[model samples]
Target chain A: MTHNPTIVVGIKQVPDDDEVRIDPDTGRLDRSSAPAVLNSPDRNALEAALGVRDDVGGQVIAMTMGPPPAADVLKEAVAMGCDDGVLISDIAFGGSDTWPTSLTLARTAEYLDADIVVCGEETTDSSTGQVPPGIAAHRGWAQLTYVEELEPLPEANQLAARRDVEGGYERVVADLPVVVAVAFGENEPRPAGLHRKIYAENEFEPVTVDANDLDIDEETVGLEASPTNVGGMETIEGVDRERTVVDDVDELAEAIRSTEVFA
Target chain B: MTDIDPSEYSDVWVFVEDHDGDVMSVSWELLNEAKTLVEETGEELVALVIGEDVDGVVEEAIARGADRVLVADDGVFEPYRADPYGEQFRAMVEERKPSIVLIGGTHTGRDFAGRVAVPTHAGLTADCTEIDVAEDGVLQARRPAFGGNVLATIICEEHRPQMATIRPGVFEAAPPENDRDGEIERVDVVVEEADTLTEVLERSTGETADVTEADRIVAAGGGIDGDLEPIRRLADALGAEIAASRHAVDEGWVDGSRQIGQTGKTVRPELYVAVGISGAVQHLEGMNDSEVVVAINNDPNAPIFDHADYGIVGDLFEVCPELADALEGAEQPEVTL
Candidate 1:
């Protein structure tokens, strides 16, 4: 491995989950109800990458695949101390599921000769922590998912991470060039610095790449190639609650005591 | 990508996850769910068990409902590395070509399902809460998206082996029948340690109780103001496990294991007590199945009241301790009885 490894962090712009709403009548998503923001966990991934770069002397590049406005997340990443940003956007890439999404990201990683690829555990909208592993599978690289702590051993060209497993956690060491899915809420992402934010806002322009530039086969890189399809969507109706409002703490306690849960 | 003919697929395979020779309950739950799908599709229900010393797990899987069991017992599979386990599973999938593959949406399942799916060109859906077989034999996988507000039904029309990871606790496990008979076939493990790139160095199990298995839970939220003493007292009085929402966990007021929400564990307890927790849709997704929900919050307009069977508008600091004392006093007669 080179002394100065290149680390690429995958960023995504997702609708604010807290504010997103579903139209009661149409049973469809009202995306306009929520403003777009950088996916929360992705910031943790970028933080992990920035930490690794600081520890081992590497360049952190933020990459995102979305519409044109998606580049804003890259700018946010730059303001957070990333060296560069790449936007892989194209009409063909739209509607691509995790399979093609990861493939396209893998192609971009390879193009940049990234020594490590970092991503969030999952997105808020889809919440499928598959892209990181999918990227590793596409490149046949080792991966660490649900990673809570990351340690870079540049001397050995390996990255060690503590990953969350069912019932427990395990520390795993993988060779450098590993893909890492940083666990949500693992670390507090640092706020963007003032000078960096100014530069990112006023002067920064992410290098844009399309499907054509990545040598992507039109038949294999878009919705036509994506296997999963949304057959239909149904708005979940809220269950009718008894709505028994108790006046005081004692009354609340008596109400709970009267329930079958005590028995 | 190789052209796939969906007609070539036949059986429904459920990947049975093993935790130290004990089969996870979700695997059994998936088996029970798969039985219905197979019944509808006229396909065999197969269980794929991959781990070392999983003979007991294989028998249990058969008794629970599997028509056939495929075993890949190997030392390399003990620690559950994605590369080897995924490679082995991918090999079996390629050779057998099951129509529908159901995996438990555990950390391990989500980690490797894509690894196998991407290589095989199979369509994989993640964390499906509902699944059924379409008339044409396609698997309809429905999952809550955008924080559980809308449920989307997904399908793979052209994929040979449709894949989905079902969230645990969404389905009930069928009672096991020891007398039930099923075919058990051993699969060859071709993956070697040298072929794997990652190595597990250390592991530590959590000491916290599993909230998902708790019959009754007393969970606190951001309104707790970083103090859990009152909630703990209430939980003790109610004899329930203590849990928290994502806000409490993120604020370091509680352990992450005790967090219940979209990104956290899904719990279906019989009784859930929410103290100072505003019910966000994300939080509701995790606890919606609770048989009885009680909310105590200062804000009357808090969304938690909408989902609560009983609501008390008051300060938790004052309400929790008084409720604890009252419940303790009420339980005195039961002890005498």
Candidate 2:
């Protein structure tokens, strides 16, 4: 039997932004106590990858690079139907920006011989949406971004995608080894199967791969190699308006009735 | 470590993008921003155009703001393949380095800008809403982060040609200054036949409402309680465009193009009426620049009132109809938004 297509889905563990609070004294996000959750859109990416596998009888691989605690998201992805999960974690990869992050993911996809790679359009924390394009650039592979729909043609070694652009959406067909960036709320994320969920939490211990596991040079994949620096953050304060309450519709109507805007 | 001396980089460059001979508006907006910026830095602003027979775009770029226009006209540039386009700009960036490079955050812009940034390592920032030069001469890009909960200003001080993808409608576009003098330089495009590139098969375009240009907007939000006709009636009565918050759009009550928020569109309409909108931070990021804002909601503490010029705390269903009638009968009231 021929080997099945290997689709590697990239996921991220970001701070639960809803639970995040600002350190009013420092004017910075207090992520220290916040819990980490699988990025919302990333779940859609995983669902897309798994859906492809369901149709083509292939395997879906969940991959992520973060601290040790990040392995939890991998477990969640595996529980969601991925056949395997790989976590690339190391102190050397710390402080890496999108460029180096893309390098690391590209190398992992290369080693895995991925036929297709998928990622959320952006992360909630950084929300740059550059890593996927960076990966496509680093790998010199065709990149389909902001994809809302995916059609897997396993026999043809191509994936047809419907992506959004300026005025409208277009259907694009790209050769295999392509990177697909899924748009937010593209698909309804499926629930993890009951059988998978039974063993997902207990049986999953992601295969950990450190920097040495790959052939990439250390100099090219760390903070030192990153070009952009987070210099400072200035908050864009929301507007504070007068909370006026008009007793009757006529009073409010009369008040706004003479304004040049509506009349 | 090899460092690029700040002194070597001289000009502010913008990618002049044209798709199927239709020039993108973001290019003009960026050129306007560049014009304002270059005046501050005393640097020449250049527009780099890549396409075949792009003489019209060349003249347009010059009229817009560019002190100089560089055109790379060749057959390979047709239909826009990523490899050749990215390499051509990368080569130019490496040869005649600029202090800053602004690319429109369009479909093609994101594709090539991301690729162009790799080897150049230009410290690319995506979806930047604001770009400016810091006191230290570094390019500062301010963008939304943490799901629009906060804004972060990023700096790429060490890299030459600090690159950024600017979302459209974030900056206002002005008409071309025809009286200005500018020069056009032609450059040959180099494409490798051996490189594999994705080809476009069939192309089609669809029209969406442009709320950014709407002088008056009547936007609905989740507070409408599924009855949009009242708001629609008000919008019809006022001859205003209908816009919505992300909530209404996501809830399938309106088209996504009409959504006004950080993730949607950045708009600065003349008059904006927010009905049933709770005034989320994300929604405010898009239309906070409106000349006048009026919010109507039953909840007095709704955040929408914070930015509104006038607030009416009452049920929208009851208030919208009355306001529509009052507006229709006020003959010759010097109507404006």
Candidate 3:
């Protein structure tokens, strides 16, 4: 079961949580006036690295850091069949967080020798689940995190998975150069096959890397060594309930026996 | 030079929890938060409490302010399982060194604090909603991430006894005072059935007797998938407590123990309707610390209307039966536990 195992995942284009656009002069979030996609929990972490490359037989790729219009989510992750794709982007990895965007995805997943990385337990535009455990604590590896289910114990090269505990759920096993983070309902991503969308519009070619290309360390990752200090932004507003817009289910069950909204 | 030196540490443990022998109100809210860091650093707040008859839970953690309880007991530390209560609380934190420990994120503190932080490499934050102590003594903690839309604060700073956990209603419980005064002291954990690596076998019992004490909480989301019959007719017109949202348990529509957020179950009832939830941030990190959040949702920019104390925007199929007929014509308080 180990012929194609190259797997990588990690996508992130963002700003299409149904078309984001709030910049009234820099409250930010204008993502160039909306529409960008490929960030629904990193397309459920690239459908869990294409379901661990369709059950332990791999080759999934898909990577991205952003800019150059985030290479259109790497041509939608090579039309969802990913065999390769990379983009680290320049401007010195802009305002990075989740610790230097996890040290630029751990120096591009240790210059792509990655055996399993997958991510997305957070980031619909910096929702911040802390970059897949800060990219498995800067690639020292062995980080499981919230994943939903992953199997393939490859007779102990390890992979068991499950994880979502707090009030129930946990299995854990890990092993092969780990780091997971999954969980966005773990798997819905698929549509994009049309002959791999015409070989991702001309056999895509990314591979960009920067920050003097990976030999890293410009005073601790970025924004002058991030230790997280975002102390502001407060909008929690919903509490005005008082309505009656109905029609039927027997007047919606006689309007729920008569507006007790749940006594 | 706040680099921690409170005499390099001595005692402050806490973990008591119990369960089959009873006593879990988050073990007196971690002994009312380790009696405020053992009265600002004179240290010695100990509790430990593993189980098996546990002498009425070490005289209820020494009447409820534990200056010392310890216990451990045995019979392979009875039913609390999770590798002999995290190896008898990591053998009383390596023979009582304790500079601070606290554990109460429950489900037996994340199964004995994730197997006692994988053999005490230490630094075990887990749930924490808040926990202070840094004048350089450390342990800041403060969790909530992405689903609660960021609050992080952590700090293990060269780990040792800094641990954290903290979830049941995020702190606020120390006020019993039976003329205060304490000390229980039992401590004999020599349990060697090969240190019981998990084998509770069977204990069942959970058909919703404690959705964190529901007083009324209809909740539903991912826009109530395939008709939960108007959320079971608004939880039978407001007798409430149905709850959902981790997108209606990822669209199966419900049951993941009626999922809520930041990994579920943390309701604070008295009324919390929510129907078509759009309040992500880990479902407003478990009902935005619930108290009275209504939110119906048709998406008037739904972040669960920013924290919903009562938002309606409409369309939960005609405002959940007109808010279940305006809460069946209002007037019905006094339902207490």
Best by lDDT: 1
- Which of 1 and 3 is ahead in DockQ? 1
Shares of reference contacts reproduced by the candidates, in order, are: 0.78, 0.51, 0.02
lDDT of 2 by residue, A142-190 (tens): 8888788888876677888887665566777787788988988778888
C-alpha lDDT score of every prediction, in listed order: 0.88, 0.81, 0.66
Q: Give residue B294's lDDT in candidate 2 (0 to 100).
A: 83
Ranking by TM-score: 1, 2, 3
Against the native complex, each candidate's DockQ, computed on alpha carbons, is 0.69, 0.54, 0.02
**Residue pairs whose backbone atoms clash in candidate 2:** A241-B306
The whole-model C-alpha lDDT of candidate 1 against the native structure comes to 0.88
Candidates sorted on DockQ, descending? 1, 2, 3
Q: lDDT tens digits, residues B1-337, model 1?
A: 4578899988999999876786767789899999999889888999999999999999999999999999999889887888888789878988999999999887788887878888888899998989999889999999888678788999999986899998777788888999999999998998998999899999776664568777889999999999999999999888788999989986868876677877667788878999999999889988998989999999999999999999999989989998898888665323310
Candidates' chain A TM-scores: 0.96, 0.93, 0.30
Q: How would you encode candidate 3's per-residue C-alpha lDDT over A161-182 as one tens digit per residue?
A: 7665433555656566676778
lDDT of 3 by residue, B1-337 (tens): 1133334566678787766676657668778877777677677787888877878777767777887777877777765555556666767776766877877765446546644654443555667666767666766777764334346676655446766667665555565666666777777676676534223333443343345567677888888666777877777766777878777776666656667667555677766777887876667777665656667778788766667645657678876775566556545555664
Better of 1 and 2 by lDDT: 1
Q: What lDDT does candidate 1 reach at residue B95?
A: 91
Docking class of 1: medium
